[model samples]
Target: MLIFSVLAAAIAPGVALLAYFYWKDRYDTEPLSMVVKMFLTGVLIVLPIMIVQRGLMIWLGESPFAFSFIVSAGVEEFFKWFVLYHIIYNHTEFDEPYDGIVYATAVSLGFATLENVMYAFGEPATFGTLLVRALLPVSGHALFGVFMGYFMGRAKFQEGRKMRFFLWISFLFPFFWHGLYDFIMQSVPRSWIWLIVPFMFLLWYRGIRYVNRANSVSPFRLLKREEEVKS
Candidate 1:
């Protein structure tokens, strides 16, 4: 019962967060099965990501920036972006901009959920600790997903130079932010821990914008509006 409770606590935030993004798709939503599959794929990739990060850590030594940027942010974001591009980018279900946010958040929260479970079990375990993880690390991944999905959505729906530009930023934008986020957490002293709150707020602000923007530009939104006018 105790173990079950801990597991639930750890997983709840990820589920709730995925639901939040999924909810934001007011017009057309991705199929539930595919979104869940993306989440599971995110969960499965964690092992390989850990293996790669471990090797990078061993090779790079203790340089905080290298580990945070190259190992943590680079490997993780690339894999997530790779998965998004190769598998879902061209899929028929990914018909609109908002679907990108929904799917990307699904993948990210999947990764965050499994990572959270491991962290919970590894540590001494407390409500406060779990709560902190929910607010920061887990939510951070979801926000990164928002950025990634937003750009990928743009890229999918665009053409020529604009499409290429969005594709590049789809990976780069999240890479930079995720790297910086990891760097701050790893380097900043506990005395300065209060700084993270403001940073998190910034992420939240930008993430919300991404969500709104994606939804606004969704082809389905215009289609829905046109249908309403015809009615």
Candidate 2:
């Protein structure tokens, strides 16, 4: 059916991206149930994010900067960070650095997937439209998750000033990145659409670097090496 095709097109990118991050956790994977729970929590927050953004738009006026930075990016990223901080940050399954990437990406992709489906159903979306959405918005969300998770991973095993710093960076870095991304997409002229591709690639490169960094310092990886040496 046409509807099924549309749904598949809309959901595939987010799911694929999530799977990629999940796979990147080469040591000490989180329980599947916890990741799914985080994802569903993300889906549930979309309505609340919309409600808050709507109120902010009315109050702040729909200027491009305010909408992009505050109403949209600020609200969405904050909610995502909140779910991570409150739920997964201190949980037992968050035992390794890479687990941060897995959980954060799960939540972000869930939010992105539902958003994609809504956008697709809102109008007659074409293959091109869905592809663009996948490459840009959905992937963008995943990248933001990468940034957040990378810092939170560091913060988890740190102490005192270091812990606080990484914790704030986890939220702030994603907020700024998300805001800048939205501003460019919403404010740029049609002729400047070409700018988006390069920016996206830059984000993707940085995200992968973060993933690598997180995995490199994983306690499980280090422990495995130590055991092999002892044997």
Candidate 3:
């Protein structure tokens, strides 16, 4: 009973978050099946990579501090991006600019869910820890997903030099954000924890703006044009 409760508490928040984002981008939401598949892809890829990374860190006789940021932020972000590029980048569902953020969020949330479950099982079994992990760390994964999606969307839908630049910037944005967040929490004074709140707010704000901008066309107009062409 206790273990089941812990698993439920851990899994709920991340799944809920992924749902919220999927709902928000109603314009060009991919099929639920595809989202689930992409998410599973993230989990499968990360599991082994994390093991290898941990092994390499231990082999080098490095302190946890020596590699935590790089492993947590750099390596994780790279794998997420790689999975997005390889699996979903050229799919037919990636039709609109906003699709990028949606798919990215799906993958990130998948990784966060499994990680949260492990933490919930391993740590001191308590509601508070579950709450914090759900609210902060899990949400952090979604924010990183938003960052990756924005650029990937731009790269795919937008054209010319500016779009190309956005693509590159998008690729780096999640990595930098993930690294900075982990670094501050690990090394900074407790007083500085407040700083992450505003940063998180900024990420959410930017993510919403990016999606809205990408889908600026009126739905009715688009539908009419398609119908006219079909007729």
Candidate 4:
């Protein structure tokens, strides 16, 4: 059926991207149960996020900048950060830098999944809409999660002022990146559409670097080497 097909297409990109981040942990993988739970939490989080955004828009009166940055980017990333901070930041299973990416990706995809479904419902359920959601919002959130998780991983192991610094960075950086992305998409003149592609390239370039950095310094690599030495 067309409806079912639309739903599947809506869900696929976020799921695929989540899987990519999960297995990228060359040192250690998080338990499937925890990842799934984190994801569900993300799906559930959509309600509160929307409620707060609606209230804020009512108070502030909506504009393109506010909608792009504050309502869309700020509120969404803040809630995602709040949950990640409370839930996974200090977990024992979060044993390495890359676990940051793994957990964050799970939550991000969960949020993306429901968001895509809603978009599909509103539109006429076309392949073009599916492709647009996949290319932009879903994948953009994954990259944003990577940016947040990388810092949170460091914050986990750090001490004193360093830890505080990293924690704020984790929360703030994603908002900055997401806000920029959303702003470009919403506020730019149609004649400037050409600029959007390069901006996306910038985000992806930074995302790839963060992925590499997280992998390179994974605490699990050190721990595994220690175990092998004792053997």
**Among all candidates shown, the one with the greatest lDDT:** 1
- How far residue 107's Cα lies from its native spot in candidate 2, in Å, is 0.8
Please give the ranking of all candidate structures by lDDT, highest first, separated by commas: 1, 2, 4, 3
TM-score of 2: 0.96
Top candidate (TM-score): 1
Comparing 2 and 4 on TM-score, the stronger one? 2
Task: Order the numbered candidates by TM-score, best leading.
Answer: 1, 2, 4, 3
Question: In candidate 4, which residue pairs get closer than 3 Å at backbone N, Cα or C atoms, i.e. clash?
Answer: none
Candidate 1 lDDT by residue in tens digits, 101-129: 88889989999999999999998889999
State residue 212's C-alpha deviation in candidate 1, in Å.
0.8
**Native-referenced Cα lDDT, model 3:** 0.79
lDDT-superior candidate, 1 or 2: 1
**Model 1: residue 3 alpha-carbon error in angstroms:** 0.3
Error of 3 at 2 (Å): 1.5
Q: State each model's CA lDDT, in order.
A: 0.92, 0.91, 0.79, 0.87
